[model samples]
Target chain A: MNDNNSMAYAQSDTAQNESAQSSPVQNNSIYAQSSPVQDSPSYTNMPLLQLNDLCKRYPGMGSYMSVFHMNLIIPRGRIIGLLGPNGCGKTTLIKMINGLLTPTSGSVLINGMAPCPATKKVISYLPERTYLDNGMKVSQMVSYFADFYEDFSTEKAYGMLGALGISSDARLKTLSKGTKEKVQLILVMSRQADLFILDEPIAGVDPAARDYILRTIITNYNPGSTILLSTHLISDIENILDDVIFMKNGSLMLYTSVDSIRSQMGKSVDTYFREVYAC
Target chain B: MLGKLLKYEWRGLRFPFLVMMIVLASTTVLTCSVIYTINPNYNEAIPWYSSMALMFSIFLYYFGLIGCSIGLSLIIVIRFYNTCYTDQGYLTHTLPVTTRQILHAKLIAAFVADVLMVLAIAISLFLIIQVTLHHILSFIPEFTYADLMWEISRGIGEFEEIFGIRIGLYFAYLAIYSLIGTIANIVTLFGCVSLGQLYAKHRIIGAILAYFIVQFILQVLAYFASLPMYARMLGTSYNSDFSFFGLMSPTMNLMLFFSVALAVFMYFANMHMLTKRLNLE
Candidate 1:
């Protein structure tokens, strides 16, 4: 809540030192490295999130895996888009990163630590659904977040709520669906976490609300933090994305930058995504 | 973090809890009013209208009391399922707290709510009984609150002499047993829900089945556990060296021990499922 605490949360010392030592754009080269297992010597510079041989298979499903043998690293300070079709394991991957679901095999590490309370403290997550208690008023929700998340800025949250013309006294059940989504986004973006994972942030909102939601996400997130936005609506958020990770059939198909996808592929990311994932 | 979790948990549950309290209080007041209104002179038959009104009031009072008592626990259980393992779990499980911490907060909140409900019911019952006794004793000339207290104390003394255990200690044991029993039931329900969620389909049905299976197992254990007590009771009669401690202590201690063990096991089992085995649909 204070400037010192906010600064501490906004950027970890290692991240600050890494940023000062080399530009994040330069560190993007690390993605070219082969998938490293846990405690690999190649993992000198810790990515914000790293998944190694990650697989999730439901029981009695006869070997049909949801997310299979996925190995990837998500760096900090970049807005990465996790693009995939429905049931492509995008949400499952996100849930694994957020510790919502455990992987049937392998590991997901946040800041060199597995998804635990320590990692959870630095990872702010917005689920795809309206997960708030309907009985709670907007102000009560704000208080709840503040009480639980030390990095949560009540002032910024209220300011965003005000800009959206959402009354703090209004109960969640009384709010429209779009309004509730906006509130969820506001609550998520209000945190000064090192990693922000937003799942389908703008899926069902109107164009204007979608624009507003994207703007809120862009403006409110801490600079040194990473944002992983998952949505099928790639073009709408393509401009804001620095990197893109294409997932298909529970495996990582591509992990590259938008610029590379554009310059090398000679097409927009969305167009490229359509071509890659075309059935 | 546990405290914060508890604060929100309490906030979420406070509405139903307050409503239950209000219902109990209102029921107690209605009961007292009915008792006060009913004529002591029943030697002469009461009017039909008055009798009908009295019957309705009494029925309504008891209905409200029973309904709130039953509803309070049901609401608590449903709220637990809804908040911890339902869609709302996305918000809850994402908070920067350990699964154990979250479970602790829920368990503590539910335990406190159960305790409060029990206390409210106890107080309401005592008030109703006290008011009814007061009204009934109005027929006698020299009845007072002090006399009432004296009578209670004398009854308790007589009970202690007969049972060969101190009244306060007996009540304390009962309270401890009740608390442990409530916690055991709650944790077992949570364990069932957690286990049920492991199924890929028909989770609620799975939960119900889990409940029945767990209840059956517990009943079997209880039967085995009470064997010694049953044997002791059967072998001895009240006329021949009946020891209250010997006759009752083994069963009570075994039950207390079992309940405590089950509560711990269920707590850990619930935490394990929430942390390692959680799959939120």
Candidate 2:
């Protein structure tokens, strides 16, 4: 696996239940270990996500790329950590995945389709910023999620809200910042999506809340769904991640399994990230 | 999905609309009261202070109505910008909907709200006139509300004699034009905001500039299109035969076509920017 740099991360620590054989990597798609092969026959031959020469350049920024020609394939059911320094295009890449931003050069194919309405159904995204309407109550936000996302579980959302001691009747504007973050996190984590793309979920959150969030993400997500979380607090989330993607200057630097990193490099992802991205 | 989007859009809009309605209703009542109770006619010989207060009330009432109408438009523009372009756009864009769906929902919602506002203001004005006239006409022995309405209906016929069209038909045409115009206006505002977002560094300023430029261009086009017709009408007006509807009909038809074309152009422009050129910061 280590020798095959392009397909190094196809092995999974938790998705070993599948008996499917390894398929050849197609169109330079980011290959990951197969899981839930029989869950959907149409996507059985397809990777969960395929990025082909994806490039994005923002306007008014000359000779600079927000996301350079990045190619990656993320498989289903592994929690992958998207690690990068500030302004390293982690968010930009994630936005392209979720269709919040358009790519300049290539394509992002999800579940054998482009990033259209169907793709959005399978990708549950929690942006770094709080996107909840402040005028709405926590309960109304639940209704909103239930209305838009067919896979969203209102009962699960309300249960999590109660477990976190968040009042459903409380308006979002009245909640503390940390509490609002928790609400947004709960809204995202409550969905039963095929892919959960969380951008900086634990950033700006307290240590206790971070622990709770990481725990919730690990325990609550469907074992059939993949999780791609982006954050700078690598050490805090390093243990839960099955794979790690290191981005530098809007390009993919290294993408491999955490186990491979440990066996070959003899270092934690956090330490390796520091040495690679040190200023 | 467009229905769901419209539902949420109206949820965000209702509070502002409510406030506007309250202001409109109170000012309508106050203006009506001042008209009858204080008698601020120049020759009535009322107290100077009372007359000043009456004039102030009148000014506020008129401006208040105008402000509410214009304020509704601003609210629609700001709502479209905030939900579709700001940090909030992260959720909106990620929804399992197309860019056209979102734009269409906003257009329909804004058009409905605009029509409601116009209707409310029109009803308030009608009430003030009707109620005040009813009170004033009570002292006259033979003049009743019915009689006034009959006279008004006949006066509408005289209006036809001059304008060469029935008052009802005129109002029907006006209503149709206003409704379509409202939709075009909303689409243009949203299109401007979408166009502005492409600027990346200066979205608000870019949007404002885009609005001014669009307005100026539309004005220039309209002037050129209407100049010949107006010259022809003026040439007719000087000959003691008013070409009121003739002047209106041709230009109105031309503007109606222009308005639809502009809306379609802006809609496609917005769709292109949203789907292909999304630059959310």
Candidate 3:
């Protein structure tokens, strides 16, 4: 497994370098210059998300921050993995990006504008937990999404639901946990959004379901859109990721390409993660 | 977007509200039928069973009427909390709509619900009174619908003459007051809940506390506002040159003005919390 991954990363490394050289503009944004992925010119221009000096602190913690000053930029069309241990501020970062939580300081820009109704229109998010009303049927939920999001595709959502053998008339509460996750994923992926933020999508699911979820994500995402995926199970999603961001103790530890990590560190991302964050 | 939001908000509350309305209507019909059948005459001796039945039907009618009114308001408040603050908030907050739009949609739906509740109660009471009056007058043999109409109009004319104000204008003022009060109530609850979210723990308890605090503040304001009217009435009594309407109108208008101001303040406060200070768990 290690040998196979090394060879794959080696090939991807070459591809990344070639693409970097071919791309014309350089990302001179503050975050891009600070990130380890800065050398990759393919992601230089027109970032989809940029966070400047973002911070979140809880009261009574006496200056202890949950997410300290962080600067980062996510370019379009890249599937980036946000990998960190529990309570390492991965969820906090995602929440800020989705405008679920207000930052203590600094700003987050999506497509060069602050997170607002316009940004929300283009960002598709699937939270880790089930956030749907249980009394609603699958069909009702589809209509709800269609009503709220202009870009939602009812046909695609229904098609996926039918393919999964899930009845549209079934109440959301009656579905199994795995099936519920699938349904939520389907709702999110059905949107023709410019950015997709999935927080711990594969966590707590069986291996079979995990594989299916990953496949669904890979296939359904718009080709030019960016996917910012956060998960603890790094090995399960490492192969699909274009770049990897490592966070710890409320600060970004590293932000680089997955291929760069494997090629330079001489090991799989999962192994390097263990070595770097080992107790 | 606001229209769509309101459509869904009404859809979610329709089930409970419809159930309440149906139950109230049924009770009203049953009560009227019983009253018509009994047709009790005060001069004549009435049977024990008939009196008991009349009392029971009246109780049920009132219970349904009052229950439905309070129940609908409570349902609206709970729905607001559950949809906007709970886990479901993930979907709600992420919608491609501004916080102000969401707030407006809820307030509009709640206002419509309040209006519908008042209409239902009014219609049900009117039906009961009309049926009972018709049945009682059947014994007179000379009474007709025309006589009832004449009597109602005469009563209105007498009231206008005594008060020096049109009866219709009084009712219009009353309706405005009721609508403003309803908006104030809903917005105050929204503001309290928004304030509660500022707490790091026991948020619901915090919300309850906020509600009590708001109610206390409003009560104090109301008492102080009525003090001038109270003092004037006390010093002059009913024999003063100032008419009763002169004394009461100013107080009534002041209260309505205060309520409208409170509603506006609570609205902007709620909006601020939702957009700026929101920290959903």
B1-281 per-residue lDDT for model 3 (tens digits): 99999998898888898999899889998898788768556677777788888899999998898899889988887888888888888888999999988898988898898889889999999999888888888777787878988998899879866665788887887888888888888888788887777675987888888889877877887887788778778866756755566668777777777777877887888888888777767
What is candidate 1's lDDT per residue for B1-281, written digit by digit as tens? Answer: 99898988888778998988888788778778877767776586767766776788778778877887678767776877888788899988888888888888988998898888888888888888888788878866677767988998899879866676787888888888888898888888888887787775888888888888888878887887789877788778644455666678777788778877877887888888888887778
lDDT of 1 at A16: 18
Candidate 3 chain A has its poorest 10 consecutive residues by lDDT at A21-30
Rank list by TM-score: 2, 3, 1
Report the Cα lDDT for residue B49, model 2: 71
Runs off by more than 4 Å, candidate 1: A1-44, B142-151, B243-246
lDDT of 1 by residue, A1-279 (tens): 122222322232332123222322223343443322222333347878878768887678676677766777776677889998898789999999999998899899999998888888898899998999999999999999898889999999999999889999999999999999999999999999999999999999999999999998889767678899999999999999988876666666556778777775688988987866666
lDDT of each: 0.80, 0.81, 0.81
TM-score of chain B of each: 0.90, 0.91, 0.92
Q: Decide which is better by TM-score, 1 or 2.
A: 2
Which residue pairs in candidate 3 have backbone atoms (N, alpha carbon, C) closer than 3 angstroms, thus clashing?
none
DockQ of each: 0.62, 0.71, 0.65
Residue A244 alpha-carbon offset, candidate 2, angstroms: 0.7
Better of 1 and 3 by lDDT: 3
Docking class of 1: medium
